[model samples]
Target: MTEQVSAASNAAVDTISRAGWGAELRATFALAWPLVIAQLAQNALHTTDVIMLGRLGPAYLAAGTLATTFLNAFLLGSIGVVGAVAPLVAQARGARDIKAVRRVVRQGCWAAIIISVVMIPLLLQIKPIYLALGQDPLATDMAEQFIQIAAWSMFPALGIIAFRSFLSAYDATRAILVITVLGVLINALIAYTLIFGHFGFPRLELRGAAIATLTTNFIMLGMMVAYVLRHRRLKRFNVLVRFWKPDWPRLREIFRIGLPIGLTVLAEVGLFTAAALLMGRLGTDEVAAHAVALQLASMAFMVPLGLGVAATVRVGIAFGRGDIDGVGNAGWTAFVLGLGFMAVSCTLFLTAGTFLVSLFLDMNEPTNANAIGLAITFLMVAGIFQLVDGAQVVAAHSLRGLSDTKVPMLVAIVGYWAVGLPISYVLGFVFNWRGVGIWLGLAAGLAAVAVVLVARFAMRERLGLMRSRA
Candidate 1:
């Protein structure tokens, strides 16, 4: 069965390699739309939490935002590490090495467990970290309460990422979409019931929200695991059988490729986390407003992120087959698509920023006017950087498909930490621009990274990025 699937995948790659731009565009879109929708649905879970917490008042929203920002930095970084499974699996399938695919998938699950063990303890220490950063004491306490439970979700959440990556490499993404959408609905319901004490539930507030997130993660992980076990094509791999067994070299390979990717993600997410901390120092309202604006930008980012993942699978397959032109076609097509969508979103942010930010707050509340106004201002800055944000992510993922990660990781660190973070600090503090200045710094950092990553992709051959792959 594995052999048959490999033959079919290899033949499909041959067809795609020979196809024209139009076909490539269609193929990429077909692979991308479900992923895009899944990403949106996944984000909606957090959006729902923010929206509800906002109703509890600005203080609650600010606290929740701080906690989630901290959690997501670690979450996304861990996911980036486990996500190496996608390209590894894609390359294996392209070369029709079914056994290798199984090994990668198995090791990906192992990687998830290892990351959870290391990260969960670190996440539990949010209070100390927040205090050291000089966050508001009350807000820090609230945030710690939220993270205590939410931290446990890291286990199932990382597991879900591993399985999702495996499914994506196979282009079996609709299941991911279905599972995530359902998770969003479930999370919303559970959060509402627990937060507000509806339906005889205790009003747990932030803790309730944390419980909802943890429960949802476990459910999503279970669904993904069951699907892999039952699906005709995936079941043959037995990804979970003898889960405790170790494949030392394969495990090392995942860490080797995944660690840099993880750091790259941390560099970018850490920039946002630092911005949140900056906002926390300025005031609760600034933190709340920043959260709203950032949420909107993150939601819009789902499109490019999905396209980036698609590009990884497509380019990985091409690289594995040694089809040089196919790699170029896959990367560029996704790049163009990402840029075009971001242009539209940029326009939306510029034209309707007020309306978008309003959706998260109560329009009737006079107290919300200040936070809403600040959020609109941040949204405008977010709009300005949309294109570059889209470009950097897509280009970086395309490089990952060719198993080129270390350079991009360095690019991210220099771009986000060295360039972006300093600009944010200078403009926001030294220049006294406040929230707007801080946002501009973010824009500057994204632009710098985007230009570098795009140029690197353009010069892939000249840079010898593909030399070792074949």
Candidate 2:
């Protein structure tokens, strides 16, 4: 009788395992698709902005592009802090610690508020930096006009990111998608109106675009807050609890995990920002080509980037359950999927690079020829790095699942500064390979990160750090 019961129990466990796998697959897709579309829409906004400004002239295009890129570097770290809340909330959900989850959400929101206040001065200085880099005076002025007006939106933008992270953690992932779609439409309509002086709106040019984007972001924030408050499951947990007092220990813990991640991200942004500055020394055409390539790269990266984000939730949940095998499986699954997608992306870029470049370039003009050619060349180097780029991002999130941030930061510092930037400088200046040298340096840095992060994730899993759900 006991033997028969044991056999039945084993059968039940097998059934549960299969069911769990199915559920994870469903959840992964559900989480990934909306986020993926949202990312694409965000990229579309930049592309649309560029296209509209390009119609105005190359100088307008260059100015707007540079301003937005600088803003991303400055304000983006706040999103990294929001990221710290994801794993914490996921783990809290797994542990059924509703109080802890509520605390994390509120603290993350406050952290974003503080970051926005601190970032304002830095935002105002962007124009000076462009001038110091020797951009055309008119172009620099236009860029400054856009960036300064756009900086006002950082408060809501940063705060919304925290809210989004918390919502995703609580499995209210659909809210962000709905919000993003609405925001995208608003951006388009407002930009159209303001940029062209349509329907009684002021013809503010580049600054108009900035104002539209800012308004859309606030709208998105409002939509998300409303969703969370109305969410039944979230309401049951009282996830919206207002803290009469801040929780110091929990907030400190968040900063401890989040700050390093933010710095690591900032270091990478610094590398590219510095590269853009150095490219200015090369010439305006070089800067234009570099910006074009970077923007295209950012667009292509959205797919794998979304996949890595989904992997985080999967890994976080598995870790909370202490499922070592599950951690390995989830990490590898994301890695494989990301690599496959990047492989396709690399092929597409290699085959259609010049064609893609033409879409963003005013190729009808003889003056635009040099920039277009250089952009095509950059695509080759970018293609080489996509797989490595995908791998590193996936591995990084997998490691985050294990709650390992410090070592990842150390690795980023060495990979980006010790190796990438110096090699890029040598190649671009010393070897005179120009942009190719810079790209090769980027490839090398990403490869180092990919290898190190993968090993780290594996080591943590092997040590039984992040375990299975069942």
Candidate 3:
């Protein structure tokens, strides 16, 4: 039964891969919306933490913000590494190689586990790292406390990414959405109860938030694992049947494709993390404001991020089938969708900057005034870069569909570190523009990368990016 269903689904995807732009648009939208909502819900878990901690005061908010920034750098980097599963599985499915699909997923799981084991210890060293960077002593101490507990969540967190990548390639995103939305709701409630000592819970404050994050990731991972195993269509792959087996070549392949991806993600995320650290040097309010503004920008970014995921699947499938036209259609269609949504978001950020930032801080509290004001300013700048940020991510993911990551990784390093970071430091410190200056630098970096990536995709034929099609 599972084999029959899988065959039917693959046939449909094959048809879609050869279809026209209109058909491709519909397929991408079908695959993207649920994933978009899931991404938003996933981000909401952190947004909830930021909101809850905000009520505790700038000190707590600052600490939690710093801790999460540090942790997410590693978490997102690992996710990028494990995320190679989506395109790999998509390609295998396109080629009608179910056995290869299973191997890719199993190896992906191995990659996720290995990454978690390596990252947890480094995550635990947040205090020393922050102190070395000259962050506030109180905030650093509190951030370290949060990291001690939160670092362990990396296990379940990376597990969820691996499963999500597997499900995404199969176009089974509705399950991903349902599971993630439930996780968000549960996380918010747990965070509220524990952070404030409500419903007979202890007010663990920062610790409570950390626990909420850990608990939510575990639940989400379990739910994902159960879905993949119990769903008739998905279980046919038997992804974990030989759980103890090692496929060294497959593992190496994942790393080969995934390491640059991980570094690319780290470069972009690290750019923002570095910006957060730079803000910390200015003042607590500055870092706090940066967090709120960054969260809003990140939430809006989820739409394009989801579209990018869809592009990877669509393009990967097309690549596997040697449909160059299909690859172009998929990539361009996602680019259009991403740009359209970001234009809308850009307007909102520009028009409703103050109102959106207010959601994270208490307007009634005088102490929050500085942070709130700074957040509004930062958000406006974020609005300006929305289009470019959306462009770069989708373009990068589209290239991933073609297994064109190494160059994009190099592009990111150059655009971000060589171009963006220096501009941020000079403008923020040397020129004394402070937080706004740093954000402007972010805009520049995203814009630079976007231009290069979009051009790369445009020249795919000339660049021989399609030569690897199976």
Location of the lowest summed lDDT over 10 successive residues in candidate 2 = 7-16
Over 1-470, each residue of candidate 1 has an lDDT whose tens digit, in order, gives 34433543353354345657677798899999999999999999999999999999999999999899999999999999998998899899889898888888899888999999999999999999989999999999999999999999988998898899889989899999999999999999999999999999899999999999999999999999999999998999988778888899999989999999999999999999999999888998899899999999999999999999999999999898888888888988898899999999999999999889888988789998888899999999999999999999999999999999999999999999999999999999999999999999999999888878877777687789888665
Model 2 residue 222 distance off true place after TM-score fit, in angstroms: 0.5
Candidate 2 local distance difference test against the native: 0.77
lDDT values for all models: 0.91, 0.77, 0.92
Off by over 4 Å in 1: 1-19
Q: Where does candidate 2 stray beyond 4 Å?
A: 1-23, 130-138, 462-470
TM-score of each: 0.96, 0.91, 0.96
> Which pairs, if any, clash in model 1?
none
- Give residue 317's lDDT in candidate 1 (0 to 100): 91
Residue 300 in model 1: shift from native, Å? 0.4
How many clashes does each candidate structure show, in the order listed? Answer: 0, 4, 0
Clashing pairs in 3: none
Error of 3 at 342 (Å): 0.4
